[model samples]
Target: MTRSTPHVVGRLSFDPYEGPAGGWGSLSGMAKVVLRSGDLPVDQLMRQNKPGGFMCVSCAWAKPAEPHPAEFCENGAKATIWDLTPRRAGPDFFASHTLTELRTWTDYELEQAGRLTDPLRYDAASDRYVPCDWAEAFAAIGGRLREIDPRAAVFYASGRASLETSYAYALMARMYGSQNLPDSSNMCHESTSVGLTQSIGAPVGTVTLDDFAKTDFLFFFGQNVGSNSPRMLHDLQKAVRRGAQIVTFNPLKERGLEAFTNPQSPFQMLSPATTEISAQYHQVKTGGDLAAITGLCKWLIEADEMARAAGNPALIDHAFIADYTEGYAAFADFCRGADWGEIERESGLSVAAIAQAAAAYARSTAAIGVYGMGLTQQRFGVSNVNMVCNLMMLRGNVGREGAGLCPVRGHSNVQGQRTVGITEKPELAPLDVLKDQYGFEPPRYEGMTTVDVCERVLERQVRAFIGLGGNFLRAAPDSPRLEAAWGSIDLTVQIATKLNRGHLFTGRAAYLLPTLSRIERDVQDGRPQTVSMEDSTSCIHASDGTREPASPNLRSEMAIVAGIAQALLPPNPRLDWGAWRDDYGKVRDAIAQTYPDKFADFNARFRQPGGFHRGNPARERDFSGMEGGRARFILPPGLSAVGFDDAPDVFRLMTLRSNDQFNTTVYGYHDRFRGIQGTRDVLLICAADMDRLGLEAGQVVALETVSDDGIDRRKDGLRVTPFDIPPGCLGAYYPECNVLAPVGHHAQDAKTPAVKGIPVRVRP
Candidate 1:
């Protein structure tokens, strides 16, 4: 454990990959999974992203019409193999490893143990989980739930659940008098939903997949496109081949944005050719996106004024703005007065780069602004999203073909969950529809979000915690506090597909309920079934699987949710739990009943090829939802979204996903795209910062948080590694670096934790 060594940081294997992403690297990643998956279900792999197949559980990227023969990406294949692995972590496996010992394992090692095969209940006497019958587990859980105040319980759902299952979960929570219905969006894209609703009068993106083919210019901010959504590479390639311009502004120079070679292409597999994705890549500082985007707005507005002064055709779309927008005068004034020196200093970019991006946008007839969590996870995440909207509305980029704001979501059905009423606010919940369909008034009290739930649990205000999916404990920003808060709860139930560290944090009464994954056949009522999911573009698709379930004891997420609802609520004709579980069609019918406008022909439309568009009115230029029937040009709160202007020698740290992992699940130890392998506990810092601190690559160091929130946080023994990140910033894999993002350090107005730009100082 000397300073020269990696400390607890596992062996660091570096391979600086030179070739473009998605060629040999993506193929090799998929091949390794296939070789390891004994008796692989090749049919599932072949049918993924196609009609009559399951949507990818990895991301929410839209599935195109007439998809390629192999529609799945490298990470999607790995997730499939991981879900369908022959290995099992059943009762016997749990009996051997005590909960205390299992806590010491890495996130990768814990999940790599394989899928769960049986229901497990924590044994307090033995300090280990033991096998339990579903009846007993459900009964005990139901009994404890019945004793507690329903309002004190939190029903958390994951993006992996189908829209049908999410609908059921939402209805069940309301039936039981709890509105604390928080899902994955609370942590990732809640800002996108909130900010867009305030700006464009809609909560979803206005851009459709067809928009990519027609856009003349695209502005990509903060998102690492290739690693998060490989399928999006297809759209980028088509846009480039159509002579469209793409500009990228991110702290790190992501390989996916640099160049891409489609793995499915026969020519790409044999040669070294690549399609360049970004025409101009600007390395903005972490939390600098607001300033950078505002700079664009300033340049565009000035250029427009100059064109008008010269008596030429106006650069701005005055007709569109007059007819379709509000607050133009005020928004224009703010941008006109913005100082270029401050923008340049804050954005870590030269005036020339900002001017270059502005010139490109000015040359295009249509443009789109695309972003990811890198923008939404900042301290001012809501404002970050509003700024992007402001930039779009300045030139009438929204509400036209190939022109709009695109928020690249991480989870597959996260947006769908929100569409179906998985919300904490009483105003956002479908209370009236539930009252109409079920003949009872639902609760109207405001409920808790992810952060609020964690705070309540820490205060012992929560009596029960139930998760439909996701690693709730590991995903929390302040790990030590939430881990203890989770243990303080009276009952904790996790309906999951695999083993993970979250399962090890046994509460007073805990149960690990194994459920079916998307890759499995969810036959119900003696008939094959299909569930639906909503992609990022508001398109709904039906997903069906042909492979067998991982274990006979496992049930579908819908079945498990229905069983719990039945066990807890009194019998009622309007709410027939058995019918909902017996046939997913009944669930869709109920959803349609709840939201006739969006799900009018739910089951029918979802069965069609490439499914149906749920219809975003924003795309058709409908702004009646906003005041004065027009989109609003929002003013940003300030120049810097991340407010640590005076913190000296502190690196702005953001959590990242390696090419080998998903949300909180690690598939391997390598991040081939970034050229780092064999470890997750390493901190990526720039060489100048290393020199400034008198440190070198491979030196084990500590990162202590610079916060006034009175939470003493530090991640020790992280091996320092030189990277191409902006000078005063650092990057590390998520969940591994989640401890640095304090719970209270979140986006204003939205509760998404500020994991993208945490202020910390490195110490050796």
Candidate 2:
């Protein structure tokens, strides 16, 4: 065999990017991805992020109340072009590629092959996908769904789908006698929903996009807002210009958090437009967020006690706590008694650092706490979230302008999906309301989520899987195991715009249904349709696709779901699937009827500028949803680690997306912010740890998971790169490192996979 030209750490570079975050570099990246899919109309690009145009389904960052000249980001362009690409995967392409051959391709290669232009089904004998009529595919799916017990089938929804589509799909699942409706939220922000709802009587963020301008302090914990939500950087820059303090706590020093130059500024284009993002940046250890936040709370409590002793105004919101919240006395006792030694050891930060963070927080009048998967994808994920809320509550931040908790969501419409009842666990009142409106008895059983679905599929409990969007195989944890379980299912249906690995890993029988993307116009019965989306701030807005359908065969997601419902359920005058499919307005009316108070005048409200704000009780300090009609300060299981007792040499492995990719879709191999290019196979480790472990910079190592489950989980051939990450903490690209995370390991309260805090032993 020829010498493999031994890879030498893949050209690791520490040269930081100094220019504005989104100037020429972002434009070039956007052009490269967009041009790869062939040229598009200028109107299509201009219409993106405009009022009366489509929302960028790239992220869930709240848009401005009004439209700007360019409201899109680099990732938004990538997502739009990735879906509306001119390249087509037709019969000839499938005929030439076999299942075995396609399985060998990388995820990027699989998706980059092209968009699925027609309905296709797996032909086991030929080991390739063959064309199938839409009616035949729908019939096969509906018939199989009917054949199995509804409890054995799962309906999965993705964030890319519209609100109307998700509502219809949820109704169909409930009508079919199963509530096994798991959506993408189960993987990303389930902890936020569980913790926030339990703590403050609401599951959504209270701060709107405009709140960034009025805040005194913004604390970002375990979130890379710049990389994940680039548009938010503009707001951070403005916050800094207005003399507000923005602090960041994370394992690695994300360059995006250090400084950002607003590309939209002309002054920045002429001179250095550098705006310091974090007034104070603290690098917290992996899985150490609970300890860190608790430490901050402890400092805040001590400061408050000292302030009261000095006859100063109370630092803690005593009036608000006494009147609006409960359990403060117990929570205060715990924080006052917290050990500084353990806090420092666990958080990997000195007492001074925690005090510094507390000082910034204490000095501010109004503050906002923001976080992402770094806090949520842990064994103590819910506790981590609750601690953040506890911190906000100490200063009377909840239900107020410029203050509250904000869990930065990854997808554009994931929040919207949850708002429209795309949950596995259906509330009894909502089910009753939907039943009364639709004239069908809805399923009342608690359904499976992402983690639960994985377990059930492995145990052969689930027989059929129907996905509205997203790459289920790649997004789920324990890929090798999930792939096997997914293949063993009786029937699998994927409704998507592009080809992903999920479509190739067929079940006993699988069908691929192509659907129109977010940017494509969905004209039902000759009238242009509009769909609503909820932002991170709980603001609802209408998104109307402006471009023509990518293909003549491509059907809208609503149309496909309606067709399936019509095929499965007998025709009925009360639940007329045909009329609803023909007119989305009727569907909106039904939504309003189902939740009259929340979605009043659905059509008219959706037509209003920036849509309309759903009534948020938390904003009005209405704690009726909570116990005893008051917000509760919950004391969670104090602090923990992921198999920390297993091995002394074990390191916490965090699975994160590179700047080049979204959740699972790889736009390119380069991560510009981290300065790595053309590869995702390198392991990022601290320089001190590299030396302590006796590993060279270019060494290729094997990562073996440290667990008590007795099952070996290992990934090999990862090049070691010494970087600025925290010691005892390692980072790797996801989907590749997903195999190292056991399916049994998940957040206790939320059931979200603990992908961020995997215990792994490295070997050269």
Candidate 3:
């Protein structure tokens, strides 16, 4: 590996993500940013994320039935102010800046230019984007879409798009004869959807927010609770107060899991008070979760055998296993046969530690398991998730009160988008039901995923691309390659609220369509409209915006979808597109008509207080979707090692988000949790590896991927920082490091990009 340029040294503090001072720092930083935005309405700012007000656009954490006085977190406020800021980037702003010049701007700088005020299209003659009318923009987009085969056009939906908007978008795509519904989920939680459905016959989380109170033990894996799901801290505090044990597994010892001082707690407001979160923390190697789970099961199975030999009640749930599950005997035999030494070598955990965690699980009356992308973005992601279900099922955890599986979603409305038909595989939603309701035959063939879409575009198979909302270029793996591949398309359109790098990097013809944010009021046919969003717990609630649009020219996402639909397909007697656009209730009614059993009276139910729970059959011990109408304990193939199997010096790299960022959006330069300030270009490695490489904390180095594929994937100019991670593992912030993740390397069954567990080599 060869280094290109020296890295800029960034200050690293030894403090945790949040304590007394850290809590106040977060609030102060949020306040300063909000105030700098200028002249924000007092009432709207105060009531921003509370119930009966706009929902927070930050995360997908579930809210309590009764809203707290301060319903928002620091990141929530950042997202709110960022969306509702007074700054504007109108026609004049674009006229002064060329695409090449704009491409030189940092992600933070680009977004800080603020809300887009008008629709703009790239004008080759001027070498800049120029103002275009909504009608003209839609006409151009529709014309190009019609010229190409629908299979050649890709429709990408971001999680920020509301259920109503997504429903309309999905309908339009299928009506145009395409099921290329690639979405943010394909990059994030596709493994959760695939694995959970295979394990328990459901595609979403089975646990509710209230289950935290009744759970005796909570097993958390691969999630930074404080930075990602801040509001969850309160629930964790309450759970700790009630004597529930919290166990965590991660490569690094995150401060959020160690201890937390809730900013909203009255008791901690006056003085420095903190609550300990994880009672036991295991430092699992990156991509080593399957091995860790296998180890736990191995111990639990042995304990059950011993207990049964002693004439005691079996440690396992024999009754539940006999009645509602299949393949338990084979799974148990494999678990019992697993080598403890190999498990320890792979998982980076001692046999005693695995037994300790298993003992906690065995003693608990009920337990809940929670995980995130750390378990999903790997070669064996589905197997890892299935092992989690296997461990929980060993004790009849699923379908019981206070116990179930919770795959914490990273984005707001991601679950809802999938529920309303934003999926690459149309088979998930009944074609007969949609055809009966909308009088259109949805494509039966499975469409492209994120990686598949990129491959098609690279091969010049895809001609047109439309992003509902997101910086797809920055979010995907092998970003530079994807950027180049995008140029082959004839046209690209971005439905967005602010400027982003994706808008600058585009096809031959590109358009940026400004749209309303979550906090902006939307009106259709002289009546205020509300959008429904589903939380991580599958709770659907109505969010009505309060503030006026940042720009009057902006259109609601629903209207924009309708505009394009009308332009391409026009109105027909069978489907009145105008009615769906005029009133969102009609969209919800249509949703109920298509999926009547789950969303009965969708309009009436979503408006009710606390909203409605889209119940899962698996939650009630119903595994009818399986071949035998029982949950199957699918056996694992073997260990999916994080480090290279043959290369002794190879290191596993894990990509993560900074506390100051959300997905691909950079809110600031500081990462308070990791104690790094003002930079996002440092590599976190264990001190032993640092010594072996003879590198100092601020030493600049390059990383080159070690793979059988000859294509070189490298990230240069990264400063090395010694930290407490597994010996053979390293960590870096994503979007910057996304360049090293190969599009060809992804989860086996899910097809999600393998952002984590990339094998790499260090360069001096």
- Model 1 agreement with the true structure over 1-764: per-residue lDDT tens digits: 11233424345686677777798889798776666656466788888988978898888999987899899888888888888898888888998999988987888778878889898899988989999998888788888999989899999998999999999999888888889999889999988989999999898899888888899899999898878888899989989999999999999989999999998889977887899999999999999998898899889889988999999877788888899988889988998888999998889998899999988988998999999999999999999999999888877889888899899989889999999999999988768878988987798998998889878887889888899999988898888777776777899999999888788886799999999988788888899888999999889999987788878999899989988988888898887899889999988988888888889978778877777888887888899978889988889988887867735588899999998888998877778888887777788988888888899878788888898878888887688889999888999878877778888888889989889999998887
- Candidate 2 off by > 4 Å: 1-20, 641-643
Candidate 1: list runs displaced more than 4 Å.
1-11, 35-39
Q: What is the lDDT of residue 558 in candidate 1?
A: 93
Highest lDDT scorer: 1
Per-model C-alpha RMSD: 1.7, 2.2, 2.0
lDDT of all predictions: 0.87, 0.83, 0.84
For model 3, the superposed segments whose C-alpha errors exceed 4 Å read 1-22, 35-42, 641-646
lDDT of 3: 0.84
List TM-scores for all candidates, in order.
Answer: 0.98, 0.97, 0.97
Clashes per candidate, residues 3 or more apart or on different chains:
0, 0, 0
Question: Model 2 over residues 493-521: C-alpha lDDT tens digits?
Answer: 99998888778788898998999888888
Q: How do the candidates rank by lDDT, highest first?
A: 1, 3, 2
Weakest ten-residue segment in model 3 by summed lDDT: 1-10
